[model samples]
Target chain A: MAHIQLPEGLPGIRGAMAFRPATARPLNDLVEILLHAPNSLTPAERELIATYVSSENDCYYCQTIHGAVAAASLNGDEALVKQVKHDFHNAAISEKLKTLLVIAGKVQRGGKHVTTEDVTAALAQGATDIEIHDTVLIAAAFCMFNRYVDGLATIQPRDEAMYRERGKWIARDGYVNVSKEYLPAEVAR
Target chain B: MPHIKLPEGFAGISSGFVYRPETAKPMRELAHVLLHEPSTLTPAERELIATYVSTQNDCYFCQTSHASAAAAHLANDWGLVEQVKHNYERAPVSEKLKALLTIAGKVQQGGKHVTSEDVAKAREQGATDLEIHDTVLIAAAFCMFNRYVDGLATWQPEDPEMYAKMGQHLATEGYLAPSIKA
Candidate 1:
């Protein structure tokens, strides 16, 4: 049960956006760019970053959903996702990613916390400028995302399986189509 | 002149870490994984995503530093960083990245804003599950980062030139080395 009044069967921020498609479209458009954009990092990696941050923020819905997506993408390697959530440094991943995640973590805390030395370490580990940029952006963007979802008091399913199912659909279709059924009639205005 | 009081001559997060090395190690380690780790997405692309998100959040320090870093890595394409900061969709980037940015933005606003279809769209644009996952994590993490910096009242430099200079050093030496006088 959510603390706020929200539509039934519609969990998380989707419910809020459905109530207002006028805002949803633009919002969706922005999401499209961040996740699917052609960059060096893979979609799964980006999602993992989100999951890790959500876990830290204690945004149950975001963490579960993204964790499922990451698990599914990593060939059902849900454990890796869990490892990252519990302790990213110990998680089985490349050094470069480790470096990037360190930066990401700092970004999660604050950009100022990110030092020139941090960038230097990442660069030494093979982090390009773009990677550093994306890491920061991902951290910055999720802050907004987490706040938006939590702020609206959206419903979050307690079942982990639910997120797994949702993640599969997301891995297949995309938010635009998933959002169609949730859109309110008044949104056309 | 910075609006806040950071320890004297702090080049980046690492210098702060040095002040308290024991606690800083974990934070630094996490950041390293998030930013430098190899993934399906290119480093440049990832940086751009971070820069754009920071810009949207209006975290001045993040926007400037990350933007400069992105600019440095993108072959002096500071314009792209600016464009993305202002409006990512209108910026020069791939369709896949554009889609990812959409998701990143949603994550920034709140994770629930992201939908299965958003992931699907990213896939359609050739985003793997990993890419999608990383995007979400990055966005979520940045939210924490923004709050931490703003929460602590960290200093933010106003000069664009300073950022550029910092970018050059970062591009060359990375985040761990401080070439600037601070």
Candidate 2:
């Protein structure tokens, strides 16, 4: 039961997005350009940053859905996604990603928490300005997004398979101008 | 000084925007739509919500800049803007805005902090679904923007007059192509 009367059977943010498509347009556009746009960061790496931040916020729906997206882009390696979420510092990833995650982690805690040294460290790891910029924005945006989805108590399906299917679809096609049917009235049997 | 090499002479978030126009475009559009677009809520009231949340976050740049904008919309009522930021519960604003501010406060703490009781109170005070929705989004979005500004440690002008001029521009011109050229 969401605070607003969103369209039925549209889980999570989609229902809320449809409730006010005006705001949704810019939000979706930001995600498309920020995450899917051409850049040095791979889709999996970028999705990993979003997932890690959501996990830190304890947003179950965001973590699960974004984790599915990361894994879908990573040849269905769910275990790696789990590892990155739970213990990313020790996970098998590039030092550069680990450093970016550290910066992302600080942004999730609080903006002021990110120190000058953190930026310098990322630069040492060969991260470009846009890479660092997108990392911070992604973490910050997810903070807002996680709050929106949870604040309204949007419908979140407990079943894991649901995210897997949606994950593949989003990874295959970018986030811009997708069919509303992405959130089908009936979950496919 | 910002961690990134933003252009010189621009203060706070504007410099950051100039540095990264790609992200800035959508961000500016979101701010315009949320705060400046025609709505049931007055521009003053909407800017007040942004100011209040930034105040709670202790973001000097966001709070003062938006407070100036709120003041410009409120017939240059800087005193009222200060009251709303420090003690909105007792501020001279309508009951509707106070109710919305409470929800905004809870959002600054965390998303799940907003309880059903909070939403109910705003509705009870004549807030529509659109107002409530916009309130929540405004609060949530400011958190992102404040963090973006502060996270990078963007340079902020210490002079209050600088922000006053900036606010007049924002109140008059809206968020796109802002003239922080001072």
Q: What TM value does chain A in model 2 reach?
A: 0.93
Top-lDDT candidate index = 2
Per-residue alpha-carbon lDDT of candidate 1 for residues B58-169, written as tens digits (9 for 90 to 100):
7777667777877888898877887887788887799999998988887776555777677678889998755665566566555655554543345555777878887777
lDDT at position B135, candidate 1 = 68
Model 2 agreement with the true structure over B1-182: per-residue lDDT tens digits = 57767788888888778887888888998899999989999999999999999988888999999999999999999889999999988899999999999988888887788888999999999998888888888998988888888877888879888999889999999998775874
Whole-model Cα lDDT of every candidate shown, in order: 0.67, 0.86
True contacts kept of each: 0.21, 0.64
Q: lDDT by residue for model 2 over A121-140, one digit each (tens)?
A: 99999998778888988998
State how far residue B148 of model 1 sits from its true place (Å): 12
